[model samples]
Target: MADGLNDQRTVRVADLLSDFRTLQYYIAAAPTEPSHSDDYYCEGWAALRQCSIDGQHILNCAAETRVPRVRGGPDEQAKTELQQVMLDSFSRRHEAQKIYLRQAAAQRWVEWRDSILCGGRPHSGNASQLASCDAQLRIDLAAITDDSIYSDMRSSDYQMGRWTLEDPRLRDVQRWVRARQ
Candidate 1:
């Protein structure tokens, strides 16, 4: 424990740092194998990163003061809510996808609205990745549009069709907006 930090606070901070390191390792390995394509690994990485940051914030704020207690920790309502969210996240199918789609939609919608409304120009980054995915997208669409008997439909359609900006800065902006919300 650091100087005046209690055992609980010390343990929490250590646990958080350990979790953060684990995430960093996974992120490093994400491009290696089958894990690269797993949504669980990708989403888990994001969640762990956010959690690590939150933990760091907690430690920083409590550095000079005492740690705050979590009131009524893990009540029945909280447990039920956790289970419900877990179920919803998987069953809803588009919960995470919607965030990406909504972001893409809102950006394009805004630019189009702005251009027509105020004679402004659209951002160059808009739909940048769309070009790279063009061939695959066309094939996917063709497969879907064909007759059911002749169609090669196998599983759920993963065609999260949409536009996306390639600018790295847009991610920061998106994360910032999400944090504020």
Candidate 2:
């Protein structure tokens, strides 16, 4: 009974370490959204901090070790670069939305007049209303697309075939399987 209990504890510890490692990897790889700088990073950091607190031993080792400046080998650099590009593109789109919203707000009267003259129906009562509506629309659309893309990227069956260790429990299982094999 004591042996079984010890084995269970060891397994739990290993799982915690694996989870810690996966969270660290995510912090290093996930991109920021331009709509709110540091939002995603803050969330990721908080998660990592929690993992560190829970997995003290693994966290200590990670803190002492220096992660390489580059992730993956040269062979995978292209894929990494591509992912970065996609992230940048999304960030730019979010920025563009903000700029457009601001401009639309500032020129609400002109926009309304132009749209009305161009045979489009007016959506709001005043400049502020129009701006708020526009901003909401942009935010909603961006969020939908962003969520879809992020979901696809995080999917277990994503086609790009990059190594993602998002789930700590899975990492533990993988390590144990490899060790046993």
Q: Tell me each candidate's TM-score.
A: 0.20, 0.24
Instruction: Give the alpha carbon lDDT tens digit for every residue of 1-181 in model 2.
Output: 1112333333433443453355445433332232333323333223333333433332232221222345555534543443333333223222223323333332443344345435443344555654554565445434534335334434632354433333223334334223322
TM-score, cand. 2 = 0.24
lDDT (0 to 1) per candidate: 0.31, 0.36
The pairs that clash in candidate 2 are: none
Candidate 1 lDDT by residue in tens digits, 44-133: 234334434433332233111223334545443343343333222221222122222222333343334334434433245533433333
Tell me model 2's lDDT, rounded to 2 decimals.
0.36
> After superposition, which runs of candidate 1 have C-alpha atoms over 4 Å from their true positions?
1-5, 32-181
Please give the lDDT score at residue 31 for candidate 2: 27
lDDT, candidate 1, equals 0.31
Backbone clashes under 3 angstroms, per model: 0, 0
- Poorest 10 consecutive residues by lDDT, candidate 2: 58-67
